[model samples]
Target: MSNLNKLDFSALEVFGRNYLKWVQDVKLHLIVKNLHPAIEDKMDNLVGEAKKANAMIFIRRHIHDALQTEYLANEDPRALWVALVDRFDHQKDIFLLEARHDWQYLCFQDVKSVNEYNSKVC
Candidate 1:
């Protein structure tokens, strides 16, 4: 892990999913959640450590800038995660629109056979 380069999280599905799984594996997911005060007090140091680690993982300049202004300002890893989700969730919407357009523009001449075209259109 020490030899691994900084993570590139673009709020895209693959990157986001991998980053989340990494957080879970590192046992830092709790720092991002709303917990009781007693537990929160005990985990304060761990939370800071996780935040630092999370910051280091964001290699993108723009993302790091956002982290400085938004995530770090909030002093909570959860805020960063949520912000990334909110920003990237739009990518899913875009994909849906593109898929709809492709389906709407499907051409019979593009396919080799009627059966294939029928399956595609279906």
Candidate 2:
């Protein structure tokens, strides 16, 4: 395998570390209790090499998702909000506004607020 492939494994480790941090920060005791032991061990092993890679992966994924929404908005101006909401379904509430002639801007809200906003908009 190439060096890049080997390095990619580091991202897994970072994901594990971040998952752990999230669990602690959020005090997700139930989630931690339910997580598989084997998976936990694997994440521990990958922690050292994966931190930076994991963050990069996360940012890239979000950017990619946003760009995809932008593309969809370009294809259909009226459908931009639909595309943003679809992309962030089950997690975040997205609001889309036309920023310019063909560009759209996205704003995120909490799920409850988003639902209320969606009801008003729709």
Candidate 3:
């Protein structure tokens, strides 16, 4: 398996998006949803373990460290995935405030410098 990129806490949003794409690509997205039924009378425990292992392999050192002990103790991939999202998704509020601050400060100084002003806005 190719190495999945590490996610530093600050890059959670980007990481979450990329992680979803990666899980889907690997056909393991359903595992993160906590929905894995037994296959052909086989035990679901094996499938669950496989998914957990797959998730553990993708998690890098830093992000793994951010998890709570309870979450780390859980062998379920859905638990880990939910914990990560819950912890990091709170940053969206900070991002929104920053964007609003930037918008409030945005200005067009001079009509003569429209190109420069447009570049800054972009």
Candidate 4:
């Protein structure tokens, strides 16, 4: 078995169900390896190629096979990173909208205002 098969976190799903955590893991790993520039910057010819390759491998290693196939044409790590973000980042916004609703109903800050107004009138 390959050492790459074992990961500290779960692989990113094809549908990006685990994308939020997956992205964080990927970023942390890349940063630790000093390969973050591969995804976040446009590189010069020499150093860029090597770093970009390593970053691509790490990112691809943690993703599902279907995602690998989906982004097969993306040779540059930066391009792949942006593509994945564009595809999955919206999930966060959607999640936040739902969470906002859940929290809004559970919040009692408005209750304090209501009680204060009642005390003043009564």
The model with the greatest lDDT is 4
Please give the lDDT score for candidate 2.
0.33
Ranking by TM-score: 4, 3, 1, 2
Judged by lDDT against the true structure, how good is candidate 3? 0.48
The sequence of per-residue lDDT tens digits that candidate 3 reaches over residues 31-54 is 443443321134445555665565
TM-scores for every predicted model: 0.39, 0.18, 0.44, 0.80
- Candidate 1 has its poorest 10 consecutive residues by lDDT at 32-41
lDDT: which is higher, 1 or 4? 4
lDDT of each candidate versus the true structure: 0.46, 0.33, 0.48, 0.85
Model 4: residues with Cα > 4 Å off, grouped in runs: 42-47, 108-122
Which is the winner by lDDT between candidate 2 and candidate 4? 4
lDDT for residue 92 in candidate 3, whole number 0-100: 66
Backbone clash pairs in model 3 (N, Cα, C under 3 Å; residues 3+ apart or in different chains), count: 0
Model 2: per-residue Cα lDDT over 19-79, one tens digit each: 3233243223323433222123243443323433333233223233435444442432223
Across 29-113, the per-residue lDDT of candidate 1 in tens digits comes to 2333322121232435454455444443442222435345545554444454455556554656666798888875677558988
Q: Distance from true position, residue 45, model 3, in Å? A: 14
Stronger candidate by TM-score (2 vs 4): 4
At residue 115, candidate 4 shows an lDDT of: 73
Deviation in Å, model 4, residue 52 alpha carbon: 0.8
